[model samples]
Target chain A: MPAYRPPVIPASEITPRSVYLRRREFMGLMAGAGLALGVGDARAEAPATVPLKTVPGSYKVGEPLTSRDDVTTYNNYYEFGTDKADPSRHSGDFKPRPWTITVDGLVGKPQTFDVDKLIADLPVEERIYRMRCVEAWSMVIPWDGIPLKALLDKVEPQGSAKFVAFETVVRPKEMPGQSGYLQPMPWPYVEGLRLDEAMHPLTILAVGLYGETLPNQNGAPIRLVVPWKYGFKGIKSIVRISLVEKQPPNSWNSLQANEYGFYANVNPGVDHPRWSQATERRIGASGFFGSGRRPTLMFNGYADEVASLYAGMDIRANY
Target chain B: MAMARSPFVDRLTGWGIYVIGFVPAAASFWLGATGGLGADPVRAFEQTLGLWALRFLILTLAITPLRQLAGVNLLRFRRALGLLAFWYAAMHFTVYLTLDRGLIWSTIIPDIARRPFITLGFAALVLLVPLALTSNRLSIRHLGKNWRLLHRLVYVAVSLAGVHYLLATKVLDLTQVVHIGLVVLLLGYRLVRSLIPRPERRAA
Candidate 1:
């Protein structure tokens, strides 16, 4: 075998790294537009169970894990539909395999990785997290995935990148909720996190739930799981992660800013106008008449680990 | 073309309406007993009761329109329908208090006082009580013209309930707007009807 040699090329012919990155961003933009248009051949496919191998994760909640039945059936994946049961009922046709996530924007290495390949490379673990919803419902979930910082580290975010923006797959053809006469929200559900929040140890990119690859309704493929923030902050079925200079718009906040703030930390003191956040009805915790409810802890009981993230900021005002 | 019917047929039809009206409440009980109310049974049960109450209120309001526009005389069933609405609304509040709020008066009182939707809903329920109590013939005979005047409060009760429903939802989507739209249309019809001078009424 002869030693490989560099191809003879003029210095002017070489494309600058910035230009190449811009081209990738353009391609990413086109892919997003194509998804929004409901391009043909993006037909729905049934999601099958794919078990995952995992080790014990670091942030394990002592509370009883919510039943897998409840966790799987009850979901807020608006892509599938708005109702809790709609996701489970209508998501059978959604396809989660052959997925790819593009991590670009202000990063040194702008690369798109196949989701399966990324999952295989990551150190997957089982983390039991307490998820609190702004609607005042709580659940304890055992998620299987790697820390989000692990993925951000690979992309090598630039110093200018102050926030991380996430975008969900917008296939109206397969996802029933994305279509129809009355749309619940703007298409391609978007969420964002301050750079520090994205790099927090407690945050994870969950690949599986209860040892099996995520069911379509439960944000199959991969989803962000920020243990401290309200569950809406955990965007599902993410297709894009762009690190940018300014804070990105959040779906709920964009719809109603005063009600749903960008920093949706689970604070019991700050009451939602519609309902009190002081308490939450723990789903599937007890009998019919006895709705298992408990006092909501600040930061969803993860205060010890995450309170410093907002140390001096007025939580009520931020809320 | 109103069809004249015998007393037996009228009584049978009235009982039939009540039987049919009670079916939803019974079905809800069965679902709660069998764990068919889904992940959050309390919320499911509470919403189901509340929705049925609103539906029954709509039906009560529709009786007048049906009689005038469609030549359908459902007048005999209006009281039964109004009573059903009251019962369902009461049950909705009961579930919220006992199951949803765990009968905690401390939290429940504050919830009613602070949350505008809850306050509106509670006021609606309170307004419905007097209407529900005076729905019988004895009260109609005793109260005379005052009975009709008092029961006009249905408009206020339903309006409050409609706004309460709209406010309770997190997002004011098209469906929610349409839900309250029906009430607005029904109430608007009554206003329009009252404004138009009926030749027959003026001659009488």
Candidate 2:
């Protein structure tokens, strides 16, 4: 086999930190952006489970560890509660077993697969990506997961499948916030992706994070982990994926269409309604460790990869 | 005027002040945890602490007004509440200097220069320093009549603090309006009362 292929602009040319963040940014900017600073904490050190080799970085080769604060405090899993820290403490009850994802509508061989059997096909990889919350805070987490396209490929899509819809688990006993909304609720949490975005290499079907079985707060059992878009795009504890011809109504979009569109890519230039999107507070960058936060990036710094997908279209419209 | 307070009452009131102070802080943490602190909590936290500081300021301002209106004075409550107001204001400035700007002077300098609210906030905080310093009984006795004059600056400081809170929020929240109304009433009452001469019997 030939030696590792060089990127278009040689590897040395790019800022190592920025490139690292971009890869994870594709995963959803904050998941593992600045973390990997030090993985040798005096805590549980599980052997690396993912197939991907751990290169030279903060995390020990293949060993996975979690920041107690990240696991205990910062969480985007909204089922347990709306606060960032609430889900971490309260999402202990989300049951992930006996789960199945509906694969009907625009796909061939449409059927449900027990989540375990589905993930059994691909190996989970350890990736460090920047996970940026819309609130401007961020974290660089080392997550264990597989490419989303690998799963999408298993259940081939028909030509009409222009969009992919995802829905979350609906048990109120485990996930209490279902009743918060006054209107009649949709059984499962639903999120959709345009056909092309669904096929992107960086899209992940995450089963675990911090190299351990997922804590309910981080979306257990199975979840979609899209790195580039805002954290909201990556639906958690999902139960269904229905491919359709048009965009399905997304949770945030339905509530506030203009502010949260289907394509919620992280762009520092495009500001959110209540705050600036120009920069983010990168959670765990080195030197600044325990000191200060870092600025956010454009397209979550993945503009080079995903920007071409929306060449002539106006981002402001879809945004 | 009985000044006898049992130790239990003193202890109970101390705990009461602490509980009242903790309520806002606890609520802030809860709101932050739930994402109810809004999209940017550094700013939200700043606004919150500023509001608390102003509340303390109003509380200080209310001491006299409440005494005159109710015919019962609670001047003993003044120092504790004044210190609590200063504590919250300190927290507000800390959040502003640290989290919001990530502790970078570059980010803050421009903000202080361009934003009038920030400028006013800094000025208010600076002015509070002397008042807080002179808050002790030692300083009060040493300063004598000058103590009254020095403490009067609290009225100016509070007004600036209220302006700081209002201008910093960027939006008109009814809660803020209510706070401003209280400040107006407290200061207004004092002004109106001072203007009235002792009524001599007006006989023809």
Candidate 3:
């Protein structure tokens, strides 16, 4: 079998930003027209009216960013629901405004700050990163965010702190998945990273995507972006940031310890229990059975930047 | 009893079941073509076919119980239902091999060995092959008493299919639990019916 290769689109073929934005506008117009015809409610949420401003980031990837439609529509926010489309549909009513993230536990200065205040304090930059899902699918995303180290420096972690635990808001009314008796996952979806990983320059506290404020489906307001790790490690809609001494329990690890390890680095050698991790289907790249499978890279092709973090640990065991 | 009925109605009923059986496959194709299968259309298509196969297997198993308890004879349509289930199972396996795995034998073989769910599902498909081949009247006439013995493999096939679905899902959601529950009820009814004595009845 041939080694997995990403289809190379010529640089000239890459869609220009203006044209892409125009296409989105045209789609919005079509949807409006459909709505006027007394058809089902068309998605009317306009693209970010105010263009998000970002400085150049050093951690830019060479790969083109996945389309905004794919990034926004195809999400894994279990709070909204498990089905990929459920988040986009159900998260419309979600209130991402007036959000606050509380920084506490094992930090010298524990404080609660408004999300807007947090974004205002730091320099937001655009960082293109490859996001690999545990389900053997991948996407390249352009994220707008401040380096996580900037925020961690403000909190001032104590010497005893070993891991940083992140928690998302638990609002059953806003998140329909949490309201039902049949819970797909435990409430207050939580994730944790080692103190070093949390403080890495590459780690980002994302607030926007595709030159716009983040959509509710794409974890609006504030979310973590640990590019090297599986997408689930980057928890969405973060509410609490706690620096703890012990390894904090995460949602997926708590749910299935064997399947999901704390350090979910994308390693091709370590296969998931149900499926092989060696290859991943690139969403929107091709047809159903077309040439889309690409070889998964170690640490999602960020091994040089992140390999030093796990020098002695066995990846298979950790995985 | 089917012969006593009008030839037109019997032919229509048989053809109707056959046509309706293709709906799941057709719907899956339509969903894929129209982008209705969500973000990962290939995965959605594979799962939809697999679920339908399991559903048809359960429906096929329920036919005997429905006749024994409720006196609703659907034996004439049972062959069509069994063949339909096998067809879906074959399609499910085909999609898994072609679309999902890309026919990577090195990985696929090891996956079957390691993953019990895949093993069970493969076993179910393998068992159905012989039964599907011998579904015609010529095979029944040739095998005589042995035909009933060979077709008994369906019970094992259905059981393996149930376990395959349960293990594959991992999560014990209501739908998975209900599917397994129905299979267990059907198998239990068969066991009880076999134990009790019954008056002689003409075999279909």
Candidate 4:
């Protein structure tokens, strides 16, 4: 391994910045045996050049190059057209303003907050996270958003809250494919997560990427991005957030029942019938070009940190 | 021989069709050029071109029947349309190989080898190459009757194309089923026509 440069916060760079997990909290998280290694250990200081891996310690992060002008310019945003690049041209019709999200269902506080008001109450933190799509492509984006937990706390989930349901705006005129699908999907694309999953520190409510306010095609205004799960799990153009007692019907699951389960925790071993999820292609790598794909990790390698939460549950079946 | 109302009009109409056929390709390119290809622009571009390519391929396939029934023909335009179909199809495959597979030949080789749908598409495109090359009348005259027999591969090529689309989507719905049915109908026409009895010629 390259000289053990410590791993960075890997968290949102929020103003009045987050106190990097208090020593007590870190010690408590590690428990007795794990804490013996010392508290607040952010891995070794990672070298500037390590072969990047989905999980740390697997490879060196050799270069900082993770994006390219060509790839970024040509993207596949399905909201605009079936083609990766159509959205950028056709999405001018999408109106991100006058947008509001209704926080209700099983929350202690139920209220709808408009765009400006929403951000005013919560802060936008710049977070650098790797986003992996189920189609096997990935991009390491510096996304700006609020911690999902922080947003969830604002909603004040009731004791009955077991799940979090999210919905994107659906307008056929703006989103032509809203009804033009060969396959059927519940419009206003829906996605959800268990209460704990929703609150995972890694989960984020993204509003922007690459520092600027989100462009319309990239789920302008607001979207949920769970870096650890397949990209589909990150529903965009969200207009609704509901804390519910039952699992919400997610778009992909409603479309492919068995193929896409309710809990789409990233699993390398379980393959989608049509394709393998074992590997992901990291776009914009150097001479490597598209060769940087590596095996996906369970819980996206956040398992050791979050796996115990699902102890004894067969992940294969869940997957 | 049919007389033209105005040779310039005919020429303009011909140019018009060429421009019309190019519209879809141009629009897709414009999207790409404008940086609107979206999060998966490579896929978006590929799908646009691929879908249009398939539509054009089907249009190319439908030409004979339309001509036979409607007495309408565009033999002069056929070559250009066919070439455009090939160009789009090539772009489709290129997107799959480069953007989709990340240009890893190893991944592409196995996909072609193992996936029958991909195999069919690859084979169909492969068969088109020589037919496309020898489409000229000089080559047709050189090959004699054999030229017609070779060009008949197009019927099978299109069926393969439709099947590739159907299987790749993995959908067995009526949209694709209708496509398959049309292919069957086309082949059926040829089969019945071949079986028809012809008048006997007097001994020379």
lDDT of each: 0.83, 0.65, 0.80, 0.65
C-alpha RMSD over true interface residues, each candidate: 17.4, 17.5, 11.9, 20.1
Q: Model 4, A209-286: lDDT tens per residue?
A: 655566776777788988767778888888889999998899777766767778777777776655567777666542
- lDDT per residue for candidate 3 within A1-319, as digits (tens), equals 1111223434554334213322432342323221221124334353342357778888877776778888888888877766576588667668888899999999999989898887777788998999999988888888899888888889899999999999999886677555543356667899999999998989999998877778888888899999999999989999999999999999888878888899999999998887678888887766675636778999999999999999999988998
Over A1-319, each residue of candidate 2 has an lDDT whose tens digit, in order, gives 0111222434343444223322321332112211221122222222222333222222222223335444445666556544454465445555676678777778877878787776665677766666666766666667667777877777889998899888887765556444332112244667989989989876777777666655667777777877678888889887888889998878767655656788988877676654466555644232221224556777766677688888897887777
Q: How well does candidate 2 reproduce the true complex, by DockQ? A: 0.08
Residue A99's C-alpha lDDT in candidate 3? 94
Q: TM-score of model 4 relative to the true fold?
A: 0.65
Pairs in steric clash, model 3: none
lDDT of 2 at A248: 88
> Evaluated against the true chain A, what TM-score does chain A of model 1 have?
0.85
For model 1, residues B49-157, the per-residue Cα lDDT tens digits are: 7877887898899999998999787788899999999999999999899888987787789999988889999999999999999999999999999999999999999
Q: Which segments of model 1 are wrong by more than 4 Å?
A: A1-46, B1-6, B172-178, B202-204
Query: In model 2 chain B, which range of ten residues has the least summed lDDT?
Result: B168-177
For candidate 3, write residues B1-204 as lDDT tens digits: 444888799899999998887776787767776776666778778877787787778888888788878988898898998999999999999988887777878778988888777889999999999999999999999999999999999999999998888766434444565677888998888898889999999986
DockQ scores of the candidates: 0.20, 0.08, 0.13, 0.06
Candidates 1 and 2 compared: the better one by TM-score is 1
What are the runs in model 3 whose C-alpha is more than 4 Å off?
A: A1-51, B170-174, B195-204
> Estimated TM-score per prediction?
0.89, 0.62, 0.86, 0.65
Candidate 3 lDDT score relative to the true structure: 0.80
- CAPRI band for model 4: incorrect
Expressed as tens digits, the lDDT of each residue in B24-110 for candidate 2 is 755674565464443344554566677778877887888887776796777877887888788888887887677666677755675
User: How high a TM-score does candidate 3 get?
Assistant: 0.86
Candidate 2: regions farther than 4 A off: A1-69, A179-188, A284-291, B1-75, B78-83, B103-204
